[model samples]
Target: MKRSRFTEEQIIGILREQEAGVATSEVCRRHGVSSATFYKWKAKFGGMDVSEARRLKALEDENAKLKRMLADAMLDNVALKDLLGKKVVTPAARREAAAHLRSAYEMSERRACRVLGVDRASVRYQAARPGDGVLRDRLKALVQERRRFGYRRLHVLLRREGHAVNRKRVQRLYREEKLSVRRRGGRKRAMGTRRPLETPLGANQRWSLDFVSDQLTDGRRFRTREALSLVVDTSISGQRLARELDKLIARRSRSAVIVSDNGTEMTSRAILERTNRTGVAWHYVAPGRPQQNGFVESFNGRLRDECLNEEVFASTAGARTVIERSRTDYNHVRPSAHGGLTPEAVRLNLAASRLRNVTSCAGRPLPSAQQIGHQTLGLS
Candidate 1:
């Protein structure tokens, strides 16, 4: 609800003017109110003087205060009942309450325990879980590395890595260290569902492309314009984009499909001609639906959060150097969700697998040119 700007006395004065022979429309105009608002005010404060309106305002405020007090009192009563009769106190809570009572009332620890109905030994006991600094540091590092993984998955990974820790303890440390993943909330009506992109069966089968924008130290804005090929174009255009694609295709095998957003560069005649010349398919995401190009979008997010935001690029050369280094780390050094292998490692593994498949086929002819093009490769 929108709050009214006028005070109670001001509202009553405006209503009183309408009652004093001023035209209703004139009164509304003077007071900056609509006829509906004037009528509503008149209905509420009609026949009341300034003193009477003041008294009525006081009564309304008092009523609100009383309602709040009543609510708080009821909540207190419930809490007291739970503490005395119904609730089961956990060890942590028991210790916390006992310590509070002992300090606040200057009571002995034994007396505090007796009053709280908790054992003195339990109150004095300290948990041995997540005991050492090394364990906490490792947990922190894991959480930083895997931002999306919650306590359960983190616990599983820790166990796999031979960390003898309990899930509940991991969860407790996760809360205490505040390592929970904070996912961005989207619009309620925004498209939430994404059709999964067809996963390629071999290397060079498919590629995803997306652009990420950022600014340098001198306030000059630049976009990291190409992925997969690892080219960072200063300007975004069809010619620039097509040239990068040509370079990538010349170096690596032509991918079957290049997935991208419906950007002007991707749709331009130059890009279209290049794709046609290379005999590769271009698949565009729906307009305004970036999530449809999820792989590249995810890469763009990491590029911004981990690299671009961390660097102060003084010039195009500096920007390129930083971005290229980060891209290398992303593709070759950083472990991906694909069984903890880097993207380069995964691609190499897939290529090796394809090679073995061909070798095992002895008499069969190797895959044709078109079939080779069907193998996947990507840039984002």
Candidate 2:
């Protein structure tokens, strides 16, 4: 370092002269310092005697030395951190350091940790964690068993099996072992919004019609008209379907609305003309979507599962007998999941409920079922 022209004592003397009202220019000229330098000295050494000024200089020298030492220590720390980042340290790094210290310098584990600037517990850490191996084996077995299940399902199963592990731990191991299920590639189309099928409050208010086909013992195919009443026959044509529907409507009550799919037999001219003449509203479900007509589809599924699949029909008469018996049992004997009542009981209950406040087409009291021939129609 270059030495200063004036000592601390001389600088303090110049500032004291300025304090005693001497001209600043005269002081600068006498000291051979510029007015700016005089002002700088005044600012630094203002209101101090020579002793205090020398003490301040000594304190500044000590502070500079301390700062230089601090900077050197910080540089060493930075170097160590960088080396550690470049894979200089592993989980076994601390143990090796401890062992080196013990062999080379005869230092204990505690002294080695202090010298190496590492945590004591980290230096003493064991390679195997408690139950880690067993947990990994269980996770692998579970993944193999449930090929389609994901991490969430595995976590649930693990919990059910009395494992006290958390979902995050399971997920971490699952990723490490590459146990994720392969996802299907194509974008999946969504089924449209599902709405419940309309239920009739009375017998003739609404009716659902669907056609079900089955093979006889002789391998000949036959279709059944499933509606309020099932009509089984060998051959099913548009005209035959229309005639059967008309007869069903007459035998039961004339329906106001009929729900069905857009099948050829249903949309034929004969069936359309019959619906128009009878003043019945025909509602067709969306094409290729059978779920929209869930009522008849569900009934057909039940008939197939319970009766059709078990019985082998020999003749049309035998088929009709078996189907009629099954239909009767379904209507009168089997308790429906819907409202905990049989189909017949539900119809009767709905009719009775509406009858308390219902009237007839002529605005007259409708005769009871006992008085009429079981063909009473209520206000829709």
Give lDDT per model, in order. 0.69, 0.68
Off by over 4 Å in 1: 1-90, 102-130, 137-174, 179-196, 225-227, 351-380
Once fitted onto the true fold, the runs of candidate 2 whose alpha carbons sit more than 4 angstroms away are: 1-201, 225-227, 357-380
lDDT of 2 by residue, 158-196 (tens): 776788998899997888789986653432333786656
Residue 373 in model 2: lDDT: 16
Go through the candidates in order and give the clash count of each: 12, 0
- How do the residues 103-197 of candidate 1 rate in per-residue lDDT, one tens digit apiece? 65566887667666777889999887445677788899987775666787677677778988888988978887989767554334337667775
- For residue 117, model 2's alpha carbon misses the true position, in angstroms, by 47
Note each model's CA RMSD in angstroms. Answer: 23.3, 18.2
List the lowest-lDDT window of 10 residues for candidate 1.
Answer: 369-378
Estimated TM-score for each candidate: 0.58, 0.43
- Considering summed lDDT, which 10 consecutive residues are worst modelled in model 2? 371-380
TM-score of 2: 0.43
lDDT (Cα, 0-100) at 268 in candidate 1:
95
